[model samples]
Target: MFSNPFTPIFGGKPDVFFGRDKILELFELAMFERGSDERLMFITGTRGFGKTALLEQMSIRAMKKRKVIDLGPDDTVEQFITELCGYDEVVKTVSPQANLNILGVGGGVSGGSISKAKHIGREKLQPLLLDFCSKNKQGLLVTIDEIQKVSLEDVSSICNAFQMASRKGYDIMFAAAGLPYSYDKIVQHTGCSYLRRSVHEEIGLFTWDEASDALNEMFSGIKGLQIDQSYLDEINKFSYGHPYIMQLLGYHLILCINENKPKARHTVSEVELKKAEQNTLLAYQHRALKPLLDEFSGQERKYLMKMSECLDSNRLTATSDIAKALGTTQNKLSKVRETLIAHGIIAAPERGKVMFCVPYLADYVKQEAVNSSVISVARQRGV
Candidate 1:
């Protein structure tokens, strides 16, 4: 049996881990080539492909050699700027009373004046980043996850700061992680030169070999808890090698197998495994999916109901096919797809093909849409 070494947010190494062989290699390359102009790296994946785990590893590395300014989405531009200044004197010198009108710290503003001032604060912080990195030998690693949440206009300033830091021989590296589409969106929103400064890495599901190796290592120390090859393959098939789900399922299995109950055994059958998977997946849907489903409009709900069926069958429907499925034209489907992608419901990999971002949603949609009982329940409640 394997145990979870992951935090709730999927940070840190799990008790068992696998895959990311090439990613660790890239980190070595980045470390070896530090202080170069090409310091920024964009790591992208869907919501649960272990982006946070990779970031946590990098965070440890950054702490060893430099200072890491970790910024979450809620950090204000003023707060961001204040931290980047590095000098307590500089922050103290900015007279708190001098900018009281523009500063909505205490909150009393409906005008664009305060909003524009906030943008300026973020934009002007670029030079400060360069100065701080130049003055300090510890260097700076700024990692902002879920960067798609930030406005495009604001991303431009952040990118400029990273570029400036790189040019000035400041080992200021910017590593951002977000959904798959964020790379193109960022490039389109920023200029060409700015785009040229960073490298991009796409995180995907783990391979069979990687999953096998991870399971082997995790259970190696435990007696009578070895995994069969067939069972391992089934786990991979069900998880699709998605790291978060892989670890999660592994965690529950270990817990169940280790229990002192009369039925306790180190082995879980295929039937039991499926039950575990379904229960875990449905729990996630109940917690995270219900709220988002409630927010959908009638048209969005109908389109998604159809889309869910397609994804459940592992079918990637093109724009035209999806339109036909929804009884709408390609242009209309395109608009709905964009909205779904933005809301993190459905995903469009390249152009036309679409699938659910969440596997459970795909299954739930199919079940709910096609089942007469579910439809009767929906009608009873007027959903």
Candidate 2:
């Protein structure tokens, strides 16, 4: 019923961005400071952890000092060169030599256009990238989101280009972001060794104070929008500092509040909040939790299920207890525990204990198991 300021969709820039000042400070210093190793950084986090949103923020800052090109899964360096060649900054310098101008005039582009980008480390991309860095006073910044989904073909070319640029001291910088395991997977490929040595920062959950400030500032900024401090605390508990979940919860809460009070002029009611919580959980389960669960191995998932079963009131579960529930020894579950921790799915916050980093994961896993059991029983009875 209200125009929601929160962006619940993945990779969207919310109206009021939450805290990432620490990371942004480093990014700014790297952007402006020469010989700073943080220039090429990688942000790693699980799904819905706001890797893409952070990249968006970096690009905003990057544009002031560098030419920013943000790429998604479908984008390629060939398309990049084609576009970059015609851009005002580059066209003035390289337009005559670039094939982009030739294609539109009397002559169409030759097969070399495709062939050039396909095979790099030769003379295709590296040359143009070097040229751009040379001609433009402000360097070029390339940010790739969902790096895991980016093709090896494209990744190699970009890596080779930037590697050359970095060695030559040309003003060039690149940043990538993806799932927690994405770095491990990509670096194994040939010519990606630089990523292994580059700055890698793991994006984690929002701290309580950060979430609190974001909630208060976001709500107070909206005209005639008021949520009681108690409900805000409830929201903090529900969201548990996960970025995307917070956005979804805020959006649905605002919606329910608007529906309950016409003109959005009153403090929200308990009934409205109850409905909003339900909507938030359902949306989080489908949009975030499901995809995350789908990525894990069977043993890892079983570990999570058993761990959820043994979770204490504080949401902390003992590894030994989970191992017992799984009919395995504590030693055998160590690998599974570490795997989840490495993926940012779980954390061993205390000695011999683990907790779900994402909120409602325990409940979602239990509910998913119940749904699967219901389907299995229905199939057996042919109902």
Per residue, candidate 2 scores C-alpha lDDT tens digits across 263-319 of 747767889888998999888888888998998888998898888989999989999
Give candidate 1's error at residue 130 in angstroms.
Answer: 2.5
Using lDDT, give the best candidate's number. 2
Q: With candidate 2 superimposed using the best TM-score fit, by how many Å does residue 229's alpha carbon deviate from the native?
A: 2.3
List, in order, the clash count of every candidate structure.
Answer: 2, 0
The models' CA-based lDDT, in order, is 0.64, 0.80
For model 1, residues 1-383, the per-residue Cα lDDT tens digits are 34434322444455444677676666656765865433567777766677767766676677887887776656534556767663353534444444433333543433333323333256467777776777788777777777777676567777677667666666666677776777778877644257645678777677777876766665564555556778777777776666777766666665555453423236556665666676657655564455557777767877877765555344665666668887769886667677777656676775778876665676666565566577788999999
Worst 10 residues of 1 by lDDT: 111-120
- Which whole-number lDDT from 0 to 100 does residue 102 have in model 1? 35
RMSD for each of the candidates: 5.7, 4.9
